[model samples]
Target chain A: MRKWSWMTILVAVMLLVSACGSNSSGSQHNKQQSNGGNSGSEAEKQDVTLSFIHWRGEDVEVLDGIIAKFEQEYPYIHVETQVFPSDQYQSTAQAKIADGSVGDVFTVFPGAQFQAIARAGLFTDLTGESFVEHFEPNLIAAGQQDGKQFALPYQLVYNIPIYNVALFEQHQVEVPLDWDSFLAALEVFKQAGLTPIAFPGADIGPGQLMNSMVMNNAPDEDIFVKLEAGEAKLTDEWWVKTLAQFKELNDKGYLQKDAVGAKQDSSIALFVQEQAAILGTGSFHLASNKASNPNLKQGLLAPITVSADEAVYEGIHTTTFMLAVNSKSKHTEEAKLFIEFLSRSDIAAEYANGTGQNVTVKDVEYTSEELQIVSEWTTKHTRFQPRFTISNGEVQKAVTNSIQAVLSGVSAEQAAAEAQAIVEQQIGQ
Target chain B: MKKHLRLLPFILPGLVLYAVLFMYPTISALYYSFTNWDGLSPSYQYVGLQNYVKVSEDIIFRKSLGNNVKFMLTVVLIQTVVSLLLALQIYKKSKLNVFLRALYFLPTILSSVSVGFIWTFIYDSNLGALNKLLQIIGLESLAQNWLGNPGIAIFSIAAVQAWAHIGQMAVLFVAGLQSIPAEIKEAAILDGASQTGLFFRITWPLLAPAAAIVVSYTTIQSFKAFDLVFTMTGGGPNYATEILSTYIYSSAFLNYAFGKAATASVYFLLLIAVITFLQFKLLRTDRVSY
Candidate 1:
């Protein structure tokens, strides 16, 4: 009984010590702030730190600059940025948000993920915010749930096929304007012992490729919207044909035969090294490629169409990353201030220049040549292109898997049927 | 009442932490499993058994369940047998044996994500060490896409899981072997027992407790497989390597079906519980009072 009493006393003392330790540290922080307050004029108040979480490790330096500028402008508000690896970010962010420990502002995708969180009122609805007025209407709609805007886009990503200019010139391969011409050019590249396109079969590469193909060939704009609404099915002829086209490239050996095992970075490396003629990637990669190999010339072609009959749908233009203020955050006002500061055209231009991407602000100019080309492509082919919306993620996964299945000796019909079943099951649930 | 009060103070912090961190979540998961909660929604309908029914008919979930069972069985058998064999070989305290033991255990200390990346590079068709080694040995035809083939991807991943963990099991077995009284082995040897006979009759029986630990630990770890599968294939090459954890993750985070994910977790918990219980029963050994 004496030993038990001593143990209980020790535990209580340890707990008290820890509690005191925390209290002192917190008071120390307060003391430093108060000292600053004492030194500064009456106008300067205590510091308010807002936590901003995002997944872009590459953009850390750029974000730091932006944060520094924002801090200078709003002296009392400081933004502490937290970043996670892209692959783990979604799950980590979701877990944090679910646990009610999300940062003041965090990056969110525009589709199902954004919608799921937005619908649950996790994000403070920015529907009436003045900063929301600066973004494109289509982009605002992309991040909308019902009638309320919950996300604010900062950058635009254009998903055109970036190509090696030297390789295409070396092979005398003309840029293919239609599906048959694309195949012909690919066959030419294959004959020259070059990989036509370095497709990463192991990741979202297949899905992106299929989306580009389907969008290029799509007869109407509402395919994805219909699928999301359950008014359509994955077994639709267009989707099957899209997978078949992807498989046809695999069959023809234009896609690296071993691509099914190769990752996105590895496949992109092939293109960057000029081992492949074309790379189906976004315009965002141009600056990085130039930095890595300055001598290697790169260019973009309009996304391929299905023969001469269908109009080319250019490429999927969507928000690169969007910011959403956590509804549960204690510092919502500061978060809003930071978001609005980012929406300024000068800051948007600086970000675009730093990141080598296009911004969503109305007056922000395309800072890079790559952005200009993307702008040209989208401008020329606006009529046929679908408005930027998040595709049904389940359907997208099904199509990607179907492409892999076709390459793995499953018949196109069988693969399509299996994918259809999976999508239908997803819809049914 | 005083006796209970004294004990309660000693355990209070741990009990509070456990209740807050573990018990609360587990109980909440149980409650959420019966609802139509999307993990984010403030409002959810009570849809009892619907998520489970959906899971029962979900082909991908069924496939994932089968794959997980295969993963668990393969990992348990391969890890246990391989570890036992290696432990026997290196149980002695020679410098070489200690070095080999440490060398084998090196992988166990590496994060699963790092191991997955290392193995992924090793299995790469064009640049991988495995394929290059085959090329060097004039067995070029034998070099196949180890991770790309749907038929073998899961097994390949399982093999990696075993490789990464078998070392820890071997170390555990070694500890078990060392704990066995030296006199027992000497007595068997003095009786003119064959080495194999002594091992089977004496050494093996004594190693049961350790074997039970290894088998049980590996079994649970295998069922909870996530990082390796997530990094290696993301349960890809056409859902060939989909396991319950990855499926549940996709359902919850990717597909936004949190109710289904919660139900899957409950099922997973029950499965692991039953399997571990069965393993404990089957591997139960008489206490050696040496």
Candidate 2:
């Protein structure tokens, strides 16, 4: 009987330990909360591990350089980093957040993804930090909620098409500043046996193209954002016109044949091989395109949908790749320190030059030829890429799908009606 | 009793792992299905069948479900016929057959992601080998955007899905073909049964177990394949390729509606279950013996 009782006791003890082990994250969260009270040299004496997670595998090399510098400066704090593929990162990061195993710092997209995570109280408040003020105020708006800065937008991009200047010059075609010339240029390129604008109707290309498509058509800037607020409808003239442009482009055979099936990489390849006159992806892809074809000459182009005189905006520009510290992170202080370190003008310049991305850090030198080419457009009147304004991914998907349907031979009005139906459903919900 | 007690430690580890790893999460997912959980937050509003009702009414869900059925039918019908044909040609033992078997089975060994990328390049309208081959043969008029066209995109991917696993299914059929005793085949030949008659009466009926396995497996794999669709198209050209698995992923991760995703998942599981069960019943799981 005693032997049996001893065995039962051992089993019970093991079960309890396993159960307790499962609750380690909860205890860790408590420890993080407790650690918030300590500061200065006392905190520095103990080594703290800060996990930084992001979805940009392309920028890993540049990020590693930044991380290495930060570690060198702040030896007491060791930063661990992980980069998830863009497609799978969101769900995986959400799972990590739920389990309290997410990084102390993480990168989030500007609008819908950030809003979703922020609503769940995932981001540490950065409003009090002085570094928040150093970033251009407008660029940082994506990360602010309820008058508080929840994150900092890092990447400044032209979210429009990047044209091959050499192709245009070789064809004796000047840059088209308005709708008529844009179409004319496309015809010229078509006659020259080149794909006019390499439109990726599939994947994220359609959504990103929305910024430039509606840039000059809208009554004001941030029209897509206003559409989400019920101030505008998808059936409105501007949106219908946007859809028509896609249709007209497709009908004229300016966008590559079977553009609807083309993904981002294929479209970029078309542009790189000089078979396509323009790549619809802009500054985000400049470095990669330059790498793929070193001799390739690229220039930014966002067509004024209206006549040049009527156009209010030169192009679309937006800050993306918002960085935030986890609210529940055990190493929040150290994570914030790393973020602050990255925000320094010199550090941001190093990042921008190395990655061929323009950061929101105040007044950084542009040494990369691609950056120098796009530098002037940064000073021009450009609207924030309006696609990021819709905080609902489904509604956003519908909006892009409408454009794709038009590209695939649907009438603009019909596409708008279908999209409007979805927008109405979203509003009702 | 002492011996059984000694074995408890080994069993306990596996039992605990199964409970914690599999059972706990599955049960938690079920719980989340009934509530409006966004997957990020711990607390959620329990809305009973509200998530279910919403999913049924969603246009995207209906479209995706329709796509899923079309994809499943394509994959199953094509994969079944091709694999069985391959198995019949090579079921007999030979050195050449051994080499041919591996050649046929080559695709199944590669990861779906790699296969998807390879196929994507092959299907490219301009630079892709498929289109170039068509043009080379002066069949340029027949060349189409394999993935870009909304109408045929799903089928294009389904063909690849079938291609990926046709070898695997062929191997299953090969095993089933090899299992039948040679004496039975010899007896049938002596009975003056026509080749066609022998196939329908003996070979096919005897091959039921393997056909059942192939059909059921193909159906399941077709319905659940995510990486292939994601890598090739990411359910695009305007949701034309959006099947249930991709739809569920978009719902949870893209839409940030985990409750709706979970609700969709329940229906998705039921759909695959009902399909496979119907297949099993049609094939009659009771083996036809020699």
Candidate 3:
């Protein structure tokens, strides 16, 4: 009986130790709350591991260069990179943010989703940082909401109409500047037995291109601001006129025959294959187009000349990608340092020239003539529309889907009506 | 009492784990479902029945629930019938039968994520193998966007689900088929019955237990269909292929509406429970004496 009691005590002690071990570790972790930039007293040169997440398959080498420089400068911190596929990026990032397990820094598109994240205080405020000062005002404006800065422009992209110069030269046609001339150019290409404009009407990106055209041609940016504030409806005369314009493009034979079945990449490939004479894409396509057809002559960036007056064309700045630090990060200072390093003019130049990205930094030197032209155009005349900055993901998706429906035979009026209803539902009006 | 006390030490760990990991979280989730929480804010309000009210009016939620029910019914009925038929044909002990059974079960081993992607490529409108084959066979007019057309996308996704799980069901049915004594089959053969009659009368009657298991499993899985719909249609072309799991995911992650997502999950749990209960009740069989 005494031996039995001794055995029981031994088992009890073992169990208690195990339970206490697990509970203590969990409590210790839970005790370390995410209070931004509050550095606890630890070894000054303590070994720290930081995780950075982004989606950049084409510019991975440039990213590696930036990471190397950061590590060389901050020897105490080791950075690990996790690249998620583009399709799953938004949901995956959201999941990480919800679970309080987001990486120190992550990539975010400049729009309503980013705004919501910033509004919820999910990203560190980078307003006073030197890197924020270095960015162009429009680029900085894209990442700002409620007068607070939450992200920095690490890479910049501008949506422009890129035509196959070789095809244009072959057909003896000049690129069109205004909507009327653009339609006429399409007629010329169609007569020559070539697809005039490859529109990925089936996908959301093509619909976005249509939206961009409408936004660019708006009387002023105030219309978009009004729309965001619920003071204006898409069913108004301006939107009706815009829908008419899109319908006009569709009626003309300039658009691809099966635009509803085309994808953005496939549409771009059509231009590369010389099947289509024109493709509208961001400046990121330079590397891909060159790779697809090495001997293809470079195309011109036909500014979306919506109005005869150059004033309307001069002030349209589309949204670009931005880098945001997770507000819940324990290492906010280190994350800020990384963002600052990447935003430096010299570093931006290295990234831009090496990866063929048209960056937004004023001091970055462009190696390619195409990038140089886009940068110059952006600097000379561009304004970030507030529509792109509203924090409403559902509304954006609804508008995108409406575009797809319209391109697939749903009347533009019907699509606009449905899109207006969805926006109203989202804002609970 | 002392002997039982010794067992307490052995059982204590598992009991604690279950209470902490399973019971606590489930109960908490149920409680949270009645609140209005945006997941990140430090505070939330207890708005009883408001989330449920919103769910009732939500068009996507209703559509997804309907799709889940449709999937459950089709997968449960068709998969059981097809798998049982295949099992009956290959019940004999032949090398070819074994090889074919193994070949049929290959899809069950691949991950559902990979299978979803493979089927997406197969259903691609422009560059898919299916469309290309249709064109080759002069059936070009029949080629449609299988995953994009809202009318047929759900059924197309259901067909893939059936293909992926039919093999496992077949193996289960085979085991049930073999468990029946050979003398029963022999008696049916001598009763002047045709092969088809023999199966419908004797073999299928004996396979009720296996059918119950397969129906229950497949119904649960179909209700939880997420990856395939997520990868293929993304519940798109106007929410045609949406399911409860994806709806819950979008609500929780995209909208950050945690309380609503938790409410959606409770609905899912209730759905699975009711379906399982009905299946067991409807398919209940009395033991047969030889």
Candidate 4:
């Protein structure tokens, strides 16, 4: 009797262990099946939550309005938005990507950065989609890599020379159209006891502005393209001339004395306060100026007086902010739908008018005067200069540093040569 | 054997975490440094010392290393002196001492990002308080672009970093000072030793362990300095403030050169290891008995 009872207990213990194992395995398998089933069903379902990440603090109100409209129309599919501080965006986004916690949709800039992310397969490809056709051809080109589209350019930016119209009119300084005329205007402004131009050499974006101004008049885009391709050296005559011009401006005391140290906001403040006569920036600055100082009368000039007689207003369409879908997102379709909706001309128009974004949608009507100026510039200038898009980040740093060097009394020729060397070293050319 | 078996559970969790988090990545990083991996792509081709060779040839990397050394020296020497002085002053029991200690340590408690932003405004050429104060005090000529000039930019950034951490160091020093027996100080006073002589002979000698700890912490912190330089100048004004960590970050994320970044990390780790080893060896003095 005792042996039979002990045998029964042993069997019971074995059965319990086996039951637990099978139960856990069964649940895991069930989970996999349900996940697959849900993904399949998600395609047909309209109700979903899509998260979007951006770093545009200044345009938060306009973005919120756009989100509200989106939510209103697609009630079942709610859109959640998160904005990161601009300075920490890259690091934060990189960390999120590493941890597999990035939002369903995120913003990506064009150039080598976009290429790097795309190469990593972090973003979903949206090529050959009807939504891509709606973007401007130049913007489409900016977002493409090896025949695949990884990002959609939301805005077409034109690096135009913006001047204080009231300051110019008050000082009786005619708007310059070419390099010589621009230099002549600088002298006149300097002689009149006014700072001629304010450039933020301390920040990289402003430094690139100086380079873009010279590149606008290059005999051919080949100079820059060759440099990018490692075929051209920085010691080229065109680069030398470009650097020399930068030095001349600095040597003549035309630029702000503390230009090298000036922050972008500080530089903008000077231009808005009419402390400086000219500032080189995108047409988007028009709206920014109005927002910051409603009283300041600002005028836009196309690519600061380039030497090109035929393409006098040659400008580069920098890859402005763009929205990309995370490849690893469970709700990729929903995210893609959100991107498509955001890219539509009508929706873009609402955002542009509401937020003063210089969006690139061709069919969008301009409601704001600032946007109208950008539209006018785009229509007039068909030929566009390609901004520093495909260069390595080190190359960008080198170029920015070279510009800083020029502002600090280093000869432009020397700075350009050093920049060329740095680029070559970075690309292993 | 039973005792060893019982001890296993206590150390297992820490061992597992360290192996997974630190050891695995470290070993992988060392292995990846030999390849041409960009942190993506399924396969990587072995480059075999190319990254190391490139590090030697890269001028920017060399400049970054030099800058890091300079930052460490400045932060350690200046911060140590300032902190020691402040700690000495705040070692007393008066209410004023507590108030002053709290005030000094306030900056350290704030995030480096906030401190950087505040300092940026304070150093702004046109709108900054520093220039305004200079103008008000008739020292306008001395006020130049504090963070804009390459010659003074790195040191200016270092000053901010030092100011931010001085309080923490001072507090640590104060604790060390207080830990010293009061009877010893009284005995020195009774022996007719001057305050300065007593400080040099008794207090400073006994405080060697604290000083060593402070130096090691400051050195490590200075070596990895990123946020302030990133926020303030972004290693700008002709790479004046570029440090090793920022350079490695730009190489890895910005340039997508993961192999080079890993190599940089390896170098940095080796450097820190050597410094730490030497510090302990040199600073491990005879312990003071109460």
- Going through the candidates in order, what fraction of the true interface contacts does each contain? 0.50, 0.51, 0.10, 0.48
Best by lDDT: 2
* Tens digit of per-residue lDDT, candidate 1, span A1-429: 687688657655555455335434644553443334322233345687778988888888988999999999999987888899876776658667543345778888766667677766667778898888777676555667778888887777666678888888888888887888888988888999988888778885776666577785565677767766678766778877877787788888988867788787778788888888887666677788777777878877644658666755656666747788877665677788889988888888788777777777877777676667655654545421132343445556776788889878787788988987877787773
Candidate 4 per-residue C-alpha lDDT over B146-231 given as tens digits, one digit per residue, 9 for 90 to 100: 88898788888899999999999999899889888888889999999898999998898788778888989999999998999989
lDDT of 4 by residue, A1-429 (tens): 576567547645554455335434644553453344226234655577777887887778887888788778777777887888865665456446532345778887666567677776666788877788778877666667788887887866666667888888887878676777778888888888877887777874454475456555454655655777887766777566666777777788988888888888887888888788877566667787888888877766643535547444455556567778776566777777788788888889988888777787768998877777777766564344344553567876776688788877788778887788778878787
TM-score of 4: 0.88
- Pairs that collide in candidate 3 are A112-A391
TM-score of chain B of 4: 0.94
Off by over 4 Å in 1: A1-48, A94-102, A302-305, A329-334, A382-395, B1-17, B190-192, B286-290
| Candidate 2 residue pairs in clash (backbone atoms < 3 Å) | A261-B148
TM-score of chain B of 1: 0.95
Predicted complex 4: CAPRI docking category: acceptable
Worst 10 residues of 2 chain A by lDDT: A33-42
Of candidates 4 and 2, the better by DockQ: 2
Give the range of the ten consecutive residues with the poorest summed lDDT in model 3 chain B: B19-28
Error of 2 at B7 (Å): 8.9
Error of 4 at B4 (Å): 5.7
Give each model a TM-score.
Answer: 0.88, 0.92, 0.86, 0.88
Give the top-scoring candidate (DockQ): 2
